[model samples]
Target: MIFFLIFCVTSGFSTLLNQDTLDVIYRYVQKTPFKKIFERSGSEASFINEAIPTAYDSRAVYPNCKSLTSVLDQKKCGSCWAFATTGSAADALCINGIANVIPSPQRQICCDNKCLEIPLKQCDYGCNGGVLTAASLYIENNGIVSDECIPYEENSSKPCFTSCSKEGVKMEVYKGLYAKIPSIMKVSENEMKKGIMIGGSIAVAMNVFQSFTLYKGGVYNRTDGDFLGNHAVRLVGWNDTAEVPYWIMINSWGTEWGMNGTCYYLKGKNLGNIESQTVYFSTTPPTYHGRQVSVSFSLIFIFLLVSFTAVLYLLSYVCGRINEGEKKRDLQEKEARTQMLREIGERRYKRGLKNRSSSSVRRRRLSSSENEDEKDTSTRMIDDSEEEEESEKDIEKVGLLS
Candidate 1:
């Protein structure tokens, strides 16, 4: 399955599909209409005078600038202009050492819609398609809040509230951090690199094709493909040492769609007119008013939780000790009662033995006295019988003499 998907993406299977299907697949990129292209034109000096450097690369000098890069997902909305604008601004802030504050793209786009009196549509209305130059102008006039203040939801019908800066709800928004594009110039390959070196990332538009959506890696140049539309992106850095010289462009589709949410376009080829629509901007230092309070609240919550758990543990330990003492007392009481009962039983047994010995001696003395009385009575009876026999013999002799 993985191989099949790879084959499908790498083999330009999307090019075989109908235009409508291709539109559905590649609708995330919304470029300005061709009629509006003339709205932003640069002097010939910016393009013709700059020589395309043969072996120069900005990434080598500014290796940490990639950390300033922000990748976004337009999702179902066509907010590429907003993403490109805010993403470049964010990189500028990071490059300037204000890494904590990331400007909100939704706020930039939504506010631009409000300014243009454009009703937002899910597909291609306000956020669906917009010009990055217009968005930059809006940001410059009415600065936007941080992403934390107004997060991107990818919803167009949702109401755009006046930011805290405008509404004065709270002093959580800083207006000094908005970026401005004072000039937009048609730049050559070297001019684009110089713009990146001067200003972190610059927003550029390119012609997108169906095969472009399936771009995996390496230098990309559409030699043959179906043209869909012009899409906006932020060109951060480039590498000439690669297999093919490529311009590192960050897309708004997602990280999963490209090489870490970045695409490598073939450098110096003017493929998709990537170098033609490049523009540079100057940024103000970012301010993060809400981030401080959020960090404080988080610390307080963690402290309270730890304190509560410690109190609970202390109570458990005290209760367990009390129970142990009670159990020990109960065992001691039981042992004392058993010992008392054993001593009482021993005393009763000794008394019973003593009484049995005294009763036996008394019975023996009474039996000896009764035996002596019986013997005397027997002797008295024998003498009385002998006397009666002698009287009877004397009376018989006197009768014979008469």
Candidate 2:
């Protein structure tokens, strides 16, 4: 059952997308006219202009930086704006020698309401769609947490969490400032390459076609399909020396799609408006000042220890009660058996006394019968004597008369 539930969740999360559904989602908002541009100083201008490479890739240049190489999935949600912003920020932090930590896109999706509250056309509206410049402003004003603190849920309705929910993870806020090249309009191809050379990786919005979704390999230049909505992606590097010049881009569609979640666009031509609205960040190392820990590990340990002790104490009390009940029952049973035996002995003694009284009555009746028989014998003898005496007298008288 657990495995089936996991499979269902995984399937729901990784559902593939088609062009017909992607067109209506409203994934990107164009830059607003009211937003200001960041004016670069002389040294910053010299740094960007000094780059001479005809072909460059941020992954090869910063091989040790995991942020540039790692690809993330947006997972059936239209929060590509969040992914592009957070991803580019992570790469910028690593390249600027600040810190290597992936900021949480979930925080922006749930917490930041700059675009929602303010009635601005260029601002973000959570997962419905967002502007890159507005998302960058959000990062600058209210910092975002690390992915370890609050992992991406790909959900727009999730409530904003004030503190980290993950156990044993320290909550840290990463703050940074952002800028867009030619802040008012779309950047040219040469300008986009220069920005890539200066910054490690940057965020850009482009029109997606149905054929672009089925891209497998090679430079994707097919403009044959119906126009899907605008999508946000990270612009990593470019190769101008190849037979067909192309720009390498990192997508938020997971590693299973395209060339390990990367796609190439035909360079020198603004196909799909690929060179438009480049946004990059300048970040600092994360600070551990705000809501560092929700519940300390020591507190958790103490709670568990107390709970275990209480359970043991409860079990001991219940067992003691059971033993006392058993002992009381055994004593009652022993007294009952003793009383039953005593009653049986008393009944036998009363029955023996009754038998002795019956024997005495029978003996008295026999004695009376013997006495009557002796009396009868004596009376008979006396009668016989009297008769004999009378006969003797009669004989004497008769002799005298003669």
What TM-score does each of the candidates earn?
0.49, 0.59
Enumerate clash totals for all models, in the order shown.
0, 0
Q: Rate the local accuracy (lDDT) of all candidates.
A: 0.60, 0.69
How well is each residue in 250-356 modelled by candidate 2, as lDDT tens digits?
99999988999998888877788877677776532112111221122223334555677679879999999999999999988999999888888888877777777
Off by over 4 Å in 1: 1-67, 114-125, 164-185, 283-402
lDDT, candidate 1, 111-201, per-residue tens: 5653321111212245568765556545544555677677778866665656543343342443333333322334566657766765577
Off by over 4 Å in 2: 1-39, 116-120, 283-402
Question: Candidate 2 lDDT (Cα, whole model)?
Answer: 0.69
